[model samples]
Target chain A: MSKDSNIQIQINHKPTHLPYSMTLAQWVEHQTLELPVALILNNQFIPKGEWAQHLLTDGDHIDLLSPIQGG
Target chain B: MGPSAPDSWNLYDTPMTSRLWMGSSHFPNWNVFASACELAKPGFITLSLRRQTATGGQSYWKLIRSLDIPILPNTAGCFSAHEAIQLAEISRDTFETDWIKVEVIADEQSLHPEGPELIRACEVLIQKGFKVLPYCSDDLSICKALTDVGCRALMPLGAPIGTGLGLLNPFNLERLRYRFPKIPLILDAGLGKPSQATQVMEMGFDAVLLNTAISQSVNPAEMALAFLEAVSAGHRAFKAVPMPAQPNAQPSTPSMDMPIGDYRVGAELYGN
Candidate 1:
């Protein structure tokens, strides 16, 4: 945990243990995440290409929503 | 088992096993989509190509193609006839299939069919040699207009999109079936529960078109299967014609067949 790199991720509305300094891909790989899952940071849709370049700072929100049934 | 359904539905003139049609919008993940599709058991799945996302192959295409069901692309999220017509052209060109679910909405609330716009779109598509299934209202006049333009089928909405009020107007739907016994009339949209799907099928709708009613359930896959069974049961029940309703109550167990009916008790003692 570097002085400026400790990032906080809120997963499913609860605090998660993730490195604030990690990239999106690193964070996902750390959690073994998958696509087809809606990935949002600050509530903006993150296309697949931007995962590596998206460096996390402190107190960033990461939300994943999977497909559900509807008519 | 083969390309054709071998029964009443002519839409099954192809090799798709699932009868349910799934949507490509509002889904959280494309990965779970396969499982959902498997759960949905659609005979043919629906796809669409937006001007922005249709440039190359989409990441979801490979997964959709892998499912082995015929892809019936749509012109959804389109407003006017021109845009829908263009989307149909692009979707057909890219997917190499012209089976389209045409949806053109004019109102936000009720999302009622703008009959004129739908007719215009259907006319154009019919001329272009496409198998068009227009999502229209249950109104016979609007359906007649669409049918006159050589549309193979009409999908009348049971209720507003995702309101799930199954078969809100059964009279119009039954009339539509009676009028066009040969033509396909599927109940599209507004079916939230499995029983609704069954009711539509029981009412003689050839098929159903929906998305939210199944996909947004707490257990989407299970709900999809439930709809599948419900649809099948509805279809079979329609064909079976269980029994006729009457003005008088009919006993399920006949008195003659009852073993304990020999003795007659006093009215006061029996509290008859």
Candidate 2:
């Protein structure tokens, strides 16, 4: 493994690699996710206001949740 | 005559015209769900949050938004207070609404709410400025606890979820209504027929929340209309002051002066 290899994190439980450090806000914009999404990092809710300052770390578990049919 | 006044009611200070609240789930297709919503014109529609799918549930979200009804997001599958509270926060953020249907299931088979956990969740959610509506059993004590914790509305089940049994314990439900006469009691689940909805409404329940009955029906839109009409009829019947039942039958016609005089005299005159 190269020392400069990409950082690994989990998005919606799926492992993904980022070439460089990225803030949650930038990652969200890069993914172009649907509007009205909620972010949960390691089971803690991360408000949209904090996404800009919050950086994705190695082995972080993130959940991107959206609305669906329910009863 | 002109149309009668609408029997509008308030939920958390928001006035609503329809007494029927529909759930957005289990429809064969999205078009059917949309059609049902258009037909029913419910006061509120329920939905939930889930981890993003491949398409990110964009189509579902688009349809829900287009409906233009107040959204009520639920913690349907949460089993603990912590989980329910967390899901509620996520729901509030995603749906942009503080209205949450809190369900903390204790038994998988019965799908009964864990009263303690539910009350706990409601307390935190209400303190957090969320309008909490807990789905509980027909237990008066649990209902009281929920109301004590600042739940403005209570949704007690008619039966187990998706059972379609239709108000298994009317006695308990009646007591619940009697105990909380001022609180809005919405029958939540276990309804299979429109008559059941009407029955509860006639029994003085403020409203009903339906999902499986309409969604799993052979015709979702038609069933939705049926429930709408039933709910309206029930509301009208309740407001119209229906006659009370009596142990003995009473003749509708007046017993005033008649050609045959009295029934006793006629019977005596005709006797052999």
Candidate 3:
């Protein structure tokens, strides 16, 4: 966990390396996802209010869900 | 005069003018879906959530938003209460609506709702402040359980999902109608034709949720209008209170004042 150390995380089932540790909100803002998306961190829903406080860690599984056709 | 307008009904205390709830799936294209929606004017349209990709669902979401109808998201592929709960939570967050259609499938082939797990999921969702409309079977006991746990509406399937079998058990649906006269009963799934929708509406169902029947039709927009008119006609028929059937035939004309007179006079005249 050094200042310049990169952390690995999985987003939407795809693994990637972040330049440094960032809050969930920072990651979301960085990705510029469409409006009205839901976030699931480690199999649990992380509400928008907590996105700022929840920082990304190595090997974290993040799922971003958006609307689709359904019956 | 033309056909009378359908009376407004309430879903979880929200007054809805349309008795038809359209499912937003399986259309040939978004234009057809939009045309259908424009023609039908459903009170609500259902949608779901999936893992987001780079540009996935953005256009679909935009189109759905443009329609300006309320959304009722579903947990279509969930198998357990936990999965359903998680999905419901995400659905509520994504759609920004408390209304959810809870579906916990017990069998893959049949696509039937798991009664016990459905109830469990509904219970949790209700506790979480969701206006849960559980897609369940035509079982009275299960319906009662869902209502007892504070479900505002019950969506009992006529047959398995997408089968279009059309009310496989009318007896159970009738029983449910009689048993829960106060609750909003939406006939969801397994409807293939507009007449089937009319049949359930005539049977006193509050609404019909349709998807495959309209989406897979040769002309989805026309089919949407057909189902809309069918549902309206059924509602009108139910409200009109049809006359009871009789065991024997009853003459519609004035038999007493007939020029032929009584049977005895007729026999004398004709020399029977």
lDDT of each: 0.71, 0.88, 0.90
RMSD of 1: 11.7
What residue runs in model 3 are displaced by over 4 Å at the alpha carbon?
Answer: A1-5, A19-21, B1-6, B256-272
Report the C-alpha lDDT of model 2 over B1-272, residue by residue, as the tens digit. Answer: 12477767777897778899999888999999999999999888998888885368889888887989888899989999999998998888767788899999999888988989999999999999998889999998999999998998899999898889998999999898889888888999999999999999988999999999999999999999999999988888888869988999887887687667787787799993
For each candidate, what's the DockQ? 0.03, 0.64, 0.66
Candidate 3, B48-82: lDDT as tens digits: 98887746898898898899989889999999999
By DockQ thresholds, what CAPRI class is model 3?
medium
Clashes of 1: 21
Model 2 misplaced stretches (Cα beyond 4 Å): A1-5, B1-3, B255-271
Q: Is candidate 1 or candidate 2 better by TM-score?
A: 2
lDDT of 1 by residue, B1-272 (tens): 43334454566254333456776544657666677778776766666553221112335656766787666766666778887886676556545677888888888776777788899999999899888989889899999999998887888899888787777898899899999897877788888899988888887776777677766777677777888888887877787776877899877767784545455545546877
Best by DockQ: 3
TM-score of candidate 2 against the unseen true structure? 0.92
Query: Least lDDT summed over 10 consecutive residues: which range in candidate 3 chain B?
Result: B1-10
Q: Chain A TM-score per candidate?
A: 0.72, 0.83, 0.85
Give me the overall lDDT of model 1: 0.71
